[model samples]
Target: MRAISVIVVLAGVLSCRAATPDLRFGWNEVDYVWDSPTQRESAIKSRHFLPEHNLPLGLARWKNKLFVTVPRWKSGVVSSLNYVDIDGAKDQPLKPYPSLKDNYVEDTAKEIPSNSSIVSVFRVFVDACDRLWVMDSGLADILGSPNQITGPSIVIFDLNTDKLLHRYYLKVTDMKEDSFFANIIVDVDNATCDNAFAYIPDLGGYGVVVYSLKQDDSWRVSHHYFHFEPLAGSFNVSGIEFHWTDGVFGLALSEPRENGYRTMFFHAFASTKEFCVSTELLRNYTHIDKNEAFHDFKLLGDRGEGTQASASFYDISTNVLFYTQVNRDGIGCWNSNKPYTPENNPLLFSDAELYEFPNDLKVDDEGTLWLLTDKLPRFVYRSLDSNELNYMIYSIKTKDLIKGTPCEN
Candidate 1:
């Protein structure tokens, strides 16, 4: 009887482990549709479009389109903003979002505060209002040709019409010499969309830049928590090893509390600690010093070693925060209702091959958890063998992701 009971429990565990999500997309290197065969040939000939150099760092889904951002961190990138047809072939070339002319043809590097001026985009956010928020990093070749091609700005598009809505450039005061807006999230009440606010983290600058869509204004707030731990700067993803001092790179906003303000869960890219600050402070912009103080932010404790996260998303359905741990190469989750401890937050799954540097994590409108794993460390320090799969994307229902785990509730 004892043997049978043990076998039953083991079988249950196997079933749960086998519940991996289907691969939505896989690519050794991303390709795109050019205006013409001649243009494609010329771009490659000019060394303007190197397949291996173009890496997708952000992911967002809207209806039938999946928006991807391939930042111009290095040369050979043909398009900085693009999208793929979800219902088309499983493996297909990307189509520049909105139109090809807007992404590549125009000399976007100098077209500041314009729709056609997206030099490079990192991570994007699609709000409940069916609007896609594209945060242009402005600086390019950051790894190889670090240049401020354009000033950092926010380029928003109406997902409903695939048209430009607004373009707000960040003021000089909103940036530090090393500012790199790596990630962004939207705070909006769909019923009243104009009051939307965007929270963008300056991973390289070590601060958070807030923008008000209605006011057409922006501000940058600083805090000690935004700094990365020097010891945590070292990373080993798969077999590639690298060091990055990226601060405050991930952002997740919870459902509004009794005060009608949300709790923003954020962390540095090179640290294992997670912290939270109220949106009230960020949205107010009443005084920078008051909001930037330590008391304004609360430490959620350490997530243990080897859990430096990059991008995170909050699931309203489960009240769980899903994030990517680049060091561990997996996703971890914690129910907001529970304390932020090792016991409360556990690495849901890990795959060195499939998740060899999970860079983006998102919860779509349908309660699905979308994860993008780009072999970033290898792409930066070493080289990603294009012959082998170098980039992968997976989507599993949020409920399925936490099944049988402490976050299940």
Candidate 2:
């Protein structure tokens, strides 16, 4: 039997106890830039500029610019990838990364992938070599009615020059039906840049697809923990009750061990349990490890009741794991040096309103912890006030986040 200890906290008090800094940027609804005046006019004339329909899902930072992803889950998402200037005005409209031509378009001719055009993107990651790894879902209208436009692929770019490096489409054998490539992490050292590997989570298919840059091939891996926990699917955020069955939605890599392979900590969006596997095992796509794979994957432990998390990042500086506490409307941390349990893990800060439905969380190269909250339940089930802030981004240095707390070493 599992020991389940639940802590009941008053939402009002949690909201007051939040110490996170003010929102860096927020909007009633996000806006974007176009290639030209004609393109802007065309987008508006065709009813493809519905601001409220676009939803920001993923984020990554490279130096002075912060990259944000707006998935085509509904109509009116003109660009799938954009960036915000850290020194620019607050709530400024986002400019398309690279150019609007590289993003999505509504034309029938644009439905196919034409020389670097992206259908949609859900996640982006920047490696130590200053390369931005983009997970192009090749999908559109995912929230209302998901549609596959192009084959799922990874598009990488040289952040220094904003030039394309490589684009690899997944092997058909690697992508199962309903495979939603929602998140990705690039594992590569600066010395071995050409021999890189990417770990992508198939949230819809309940498996992870590994890609090799050197071999230019991909393979799929599965474990029972990739599936969602049905008992933990129920969610109540801001009085909006709903259920989610997303699987294997979060992945965080620790500093490399003595053997030079890192430990990957992952969790399902609909489950409270955290699990782990070695990078050495996942790197070998050629191996069929049905018998060996079972014992290779280990369960870390449950995070606690109603503590299902989304995006996670393992800070090498503090040897801590920071995650978005979705159900509790807060931010949480766990000192990886200790065991993964309720007493060892703590929800450091929470706010019923400010942190409502926190979606994406990331730790940038500067040791800053960034978070993006969309109040998604209100937007999906109820209605968002056009004049009220619905989507927001917040950031704070990791050192300050765990200075005196037990999260620090």
Candidate 3:
């Protein structure tokens, strides 16, 4: 009887353990095979290939389309927006249409200063009246002077027509506002107001500036909102993203000094205020020590002094940060200071554990994650899960994607 009781107790404990749910949160590596040779020479010799932008800064997805922006070094501009269509693919490797001639008509480039480059795409929303707002940070002089702008501001693009709608310049009459307005979060679909709100993480401005999207016919600010926190030195707040499920937004902040550390911030707004009252979601998150994690690298300063800079993310129902960096060996991941996973090492594309600097990443409505890789001939596609730990690439149809099926079929 004693032996039986002991066996029954052990069995009950095992059953309870098995019944508990497993929690798996985090990204695994994926590999993709392409019909086109990844060799730059082959692709270039085949067609009128544009320069592969290795510097990925921002990404946006809407209406079954993916938009990616990369810094253009030769042109001294940042209008490298590539559109990918997952709907039409004949072979296993989906062909990429790098030009606007295929689907949408191309428009004239709205040029900024020669040193200006797009840091990231903050928001992509079709307003109730039908307008697309693109918030960006413009540099007066990146290599020359640090912050010499009226200030980096937001630029709006009309989604239906792909035209330059408006540009919002940040300034104050008396003060010299050298704002590093790099990232933003827009609640375009707020329940309360006809006017949408924009939260700008101005690294140099030292706080967030809130703005209303409702504008006059002349493209002027009819009414706006601003929030600044002088005590927290809110200036270093760089990367901003929205996590809908968590009921809050996330901000990746850099240290004030060049040699200082970084943190992950959470901004929760009171629902009653319609997200008006913003407070720190997670203050000063120094989870990873700067020294141990980055000990292998010495900051790059050859052409320009490489500072602690630039970040992107992969939002798999949650936010996972992405950016580029140079390993100790001197290989540059767009020269940004994004973290490198030990399992997903940098500088290779396949087979072995390789890490490609994802300057921008997004998950379309269909649950497919798109990554804009920082390679010589920059690559873009949906990452297919090969197994629990491994990922592969594929170019599939939109119909199949919407149905939650892999395009390989």
Candidate 4:
């Protein structure tokens, strides 16, 4: 009797251990178009199921709520921002943000005051205080025409009130070129009490601009070090991530003319400092030696190689940097090896989790990375077993590299 009991207990223990999850770091899209009546019935039976939106661009998960900002363009019209919810209920559109039409003029009352000028929200973020940060990059008329309108302002909305709080304006015109605010991330606490900084990748200006929440004037605006060479008269910046721990900022450069479509690159800044110039001292403000305060830079690119799509650093855990490489024809991780690059850098993970149309890739507190793919049909999801093969969110554990070890290349 004792031997039989031991065998049963051992079997139970083995079963439990087998159920434990492992980090394979791979995923796939579960094609739901071929679902059967029974499967459809089962999905409907669960209230947690929700419809998926069109191509998703940016993603942010705060607490139990997940926000995805997807931009959709209609012919002869401005793009639209589609917000969605995850976790509690698959992917459901929370709200819709219209695209910005006019941006060149300095008229705030007609633009900011009017709800018609609000463009698609490119990125969504939540501060430590649970305040939602929405970045509306007014508009960029890529196609040359007098009818086209461009926007250069960043509008802040209070999530609790769903009302516009403060508007941060970026003074840039001649939108015919590729110059406009691209991406934004808010750092509420930066050793200087509570503050928020906006990073603007001005492709038209060929540099990165920094703005402070505490500043009310444009004279205080600062431009960081930009050593990038433009390609085909189009050297635009894409994404920006803030590194609070190291006091460094990571900025991504869009593909140059030579590189194929969607190729990506990133640069890092260290020991960043900022100051405000009041309206009274606007004329007294002097540009200081920015290089003296500069420390080091890490370049993630190859003159000729795989494409680097996007990049971002998890604000919660400042250790690792995450970037994306698009694979339309089924290509995998991006390969870049320039001087001062980490040999083991561009750490290639398995393509099992790679999406067909990858955009707006972001990492969360648990090291879990999320991407809004271009292939989400009417709906998408992941089951317990097939979850590993679909859009279901999963936790990831990465081993930190030891001292003096290569992290990228």
Candidate 5:
């Protein structure tokens, strides 16, 4: 009778364990592919076949279209901006933005006018108001000898109508000759698009620039936090070891508080440390130069070695920050309400084959997180395997990711 009771107790425990549902990380589906030679040739020809270099760095979505930026940093390409129709197939070709005639191959002048169009764009941001913000670095061949075609500027366009809304040039006083405006984040007023603020990170100049829509003025804010740590400069991605001194590459904005102000979280590409500052302090330009005014800038914590990130996006509804861990070949997440520690911020997904180097992350209107991965190490240090997909775009539900961690609440 005791043996029978033992067997029944074991069976009950097994049944309880079986009833528990298995938790999953998240389901990522490939939305676009840019790996085949035919695809590369097609994209190159679509852009007028200016320069053979075709590598996607930044991504944004508006309506049913996906916008991808192909920086001229490598081969001085003609069209720096391109878009893909989501309604088309995964292998659909990329079309130049605005128009193919606007991006001419012969217009390779040393200093193209910023008012003409997009000279060279490193990254782009599509706001909630259906406005696309293009961060034009205004420099060509960034990886090689950079040629300043025009001064760095922000070009705003109405995505709904496909019209140029405004073009605000960054003052020369706020930038250096080597300044590279890489990433940008737009902060809009509550329930309105007017009186917006655009924060841009000067990755090469080691500073942050704030542009006000209401004032039509801009200011450059410099802090030691923008610089990279020496020890974290070396990176090993996909078995390729490299050393980069890039500073202030990624930027993200938290949801606005009761006072209609948001917190800005940023990090250097060559460092594992994350830092943040309130937008209120940044908007007040008078005290930005003062050392005491930067007291609000706080060092969140280190993400540990081999966790350097390229881009980050914060979900307002979930209050969770999602960032791409390039070196780890996956994405990591941290709950703003919890401590920023390794235990709290776990690797949401890490795949050696699927995620070579997740370079960009953006959140869309439907609460979907989009990621763009380009095997940058292979494209730069080594030759890309044409047989394998070099560039890929993936999307996963933000709500599903939040459920994978304690941030679900």
Candidate 6:
């Protein structure tokens, strides 16, 4: 009887392990369609084009259009923000958002008349109210001696019309010279969009900036959790060794509570630990300096010994937080209500070759989770083997993945 009981317990454990679903492939070997030949020639004539350096980094879907941002960090600065039609061909051509004529097509060294538009967007969020909030880092040549041409700012546009609505620049006091505004998450009132809050992570400077849409004000919040763990900086991806000391790269917000508050989960890029703080504490700028505000932070748990992540998204429907585990070359998930343990948080999907570095993730309104993997390590350590399909975007049904986990209903 004892032997039988042990066998039953072992079988149950095996079943649970086998129940974790593999991420479904939506698109494979995706490639961006470059600007028209005439447009490229014109851009080259203006001394603002480079063919080899363009790389897609940030991604977000709005309605039938899928948006992508290629920052002016490593190479040319032609079309920094563009989108492709979802219903189009597999290798859909990317068209500039709003319109190509609206953007500054001059040289990268030249300044444009309107700083309000997206100078260089690293990440953008499409809110519940159909507004696209973009984080314009305003930095060109990010790796080769960064320069802050325009101050970092938050810009919002009506997704339906693609018209600019608001632009709030970060004050010098709110950001450091070394600041790299890479990721942002928005919290909006369900009924109204006026009362909204934005959280931007300054990955390079080691802090988080909180922006208030109602007040038109912003503040910086610093904590030890925002800094990277030095020992965790070393990384080995696809047999390439490299190191980065990025801090606070990813942020995800939980569903609003009964009191209309949410929990903010964030983590550093080069660390395995995750931390959380209440949105209530962050919204109260009037009392942010108080010691109580500092003490509200809680360490969730470590991901694993050498695991690191880039982008994370929380699906309110399933109460599951999905994140890109870059080192693991896959996506990892956890039920926010469950204890942040290895057993609770498991690798939902993994593919060393296909998921070289799953850099960004988003949960669309259609109940599908979208992912973008841009062989980032290969791009950085050595030149990307363009002949071998370097960048890929994939999607998986969120409910299908959470079925057997604690997030399941």
Estimate the lDDT of model 3: 0.31
- In model 6, residue pairs whose N, Cα or C atoms come closer than 3 Å (at least 3 residues apart or on different chains), thus clashing, are none
RMSD to native, candidate 3:
17.8
**Models ranked on lDDT:** 1, 2, 6, 5, 4, 3
Candidates in order, TM-scores: namely 0.93, 0.93, 0.41, 0.54, 0.86, 0.89
How many residue-pair clashes does candidate 6 contain?
0
Candidate 6 Cα misplacement greater than 4 A, ranges: 1-36, 44-47, 105-107, 406-409
User: Residue 296 error for model 1, in Å?
Assistant: 2.4
Q: Count the backbone clashes (under 3 Å) in each candidate.
A: 1, 0, 12, 18, 0, 0
How far residue 181's Cα lies from its native spot in candidate 2, in Å, is: 1.0
Please give the range of 10 consecutive residues that has the lowest summed lDDT in model 3: 268-277
- Quick one: RMSD of model 6? 7.5
Worst 10 residues of 1 by lDDT: 1-10
lDDT (tens digit, per residue) of candidate 5 on 39-154? 54775666534333567788898888888887775653657777887665554556677754444332346755435477777689998788899998777766666677777888
Q: Give the lDDT of residue 65 in candidate 3.
A: 50
lDDT of each: 0.82, 0.82, 0.31, 0.37, 0.76, 0.76
* Predicted candidate 6 versus true structure: per-residue lDDT over 207-233, tens digit per residue: 999999989999988888899999899
Candidate 1 ranges beyond 4 A from true positions:
1-18, 105-114, 287-293
By TM-score, how accurate is candidate 5?
0.86
Q: Which 10 residues in a row give candidate 4 its minimum summed lDDT? A: 271-280
The global Cα lDDT (0 to 1) of model 4 is: 0.37
Q: TM-score of model 1 relative to the true fold?
A: 0.93
Segments of candidate 3 deviating more than 4 angstroms: 1-54, 72-78, 88-131, 144-151, 163-165, 173-178, 190-193, 215-353, 375-409
Q: For residues 1-409, what per-residue lDDT tens digits would candidate 1 score against the true structure?
A: 2322333354356446655555677777889988899998988888878888888888999888887788886777878888887776545788898776676732325444445566788899999899999988776667775667677888899887888998888999998888777678999988989999999999888999999988999998888999998989998877667888989988999999999999999999899999999999888765656734559889998888888898899999999999887888788989888888888888887767566788897888899888888888778777777667666677789998798888888
What local lDDT score does residue 136 receive in model 2, on the 0 to 100 scale?
A: 88
Candidate no. 6 TM-score: 0.89
